[model samples]
Target chain A: MDIRKQFGANVRKHRQATGLSQEQFALQHDIDRTYVSGIERGKRNPTIVIVNKFAKALDVSIADLFDGCD
Target chain B: MDIRKQFGANVRKHRQATGLSQEQFALQHDIDRTYVSGIERGKRNPTIVIVNKFAKALDVSIADLFDGCD
Candidate 1:
């Protein structure tokens, strides 16, 4: 699988685990809802800074977001 | 220090530990050296795909790149 897609899947898993809708997640994290949607769909390439935002918003470590993808 | 700066410092630390110059590292990873420099300097926001490239190139995990940076 493409790494980006794997990453996106991981993100989706964790995001869903948090029980927030995509729009709610983005608004709570101060990220654009469309950007969040794009990332969840693996159509967007989110930067490390943005990755940090996701991690922070999700309350997970960067590694945690990537767990078991390999 | 800002988290981004901390992230940059961590990248520099791991990159240097590989004993490759920034240019060499970037070339080996197919990343632009200028982009690597910007990332190391906390001046660029690299996507998770790029971050994965850096982690793969540096022989580290995404978590490892962010160790002790909280």
Candidate 2:
């Protein structure tokens, strides 16, 4: 599968599930909104550190972001 | 937890389980041996693309590399 796109879709799913728009999620997570946008669109390739940050921000396991990706 | 360190350890564990040296693994994956070395040492910040490459090379899920990281 296309892991990046899957990851983006997963992130979007979780983020929306939390009732947080991209701007709110980015603000709460101290991430750039544009960066979050890029990530959610699968246009950004984030380092593991950033991935960890996303996992923490989303309150999900790193694996959760990769669900359906493998 | 130090996600990078945990990821490196997981990679090492999986790599060793496959009975392949870093050099061999790098060559087989078309990655730089030095980059692999850096990753195993927790000194590199690899993007998800590279992480996916490693997972594919090691025949593990991308989440497997971050197994204990979250």
Candidate 1 regions exceeding 4 Å error are none
lDDT of 1 by residue, A1-70 (tens): 6666777888899999999999888888788888888887888887777777787888888777667544
Candidate 1 per-residue C-alpha lDDT over B1-70 given as tens digits, one digit per residue, 9 for 90 to 100: 6667777888999999999999998888888899889889988777777777777888888888777654
Give the top-scoring candidate (TM-score). 2
lDDT of 2 by residue, B13-39 (tens): 999999999999888888999999889
**Per-chain TM-score, chain A, candidate 2:** 0.94
How does model 2 score on DockQ? 0.88
Residue B7 accuracy (lDDT) in model 1: 77
Candidate 2 per-residue lDDT over residues A1-70, each given as its tens digit: 5677888988899999999999999999889999999888998888999989998899999999988877
Number of the predicted model whose lDDT against the real structure is largest: 2
Estimate TM-scores for all models: 0.83, 0.96
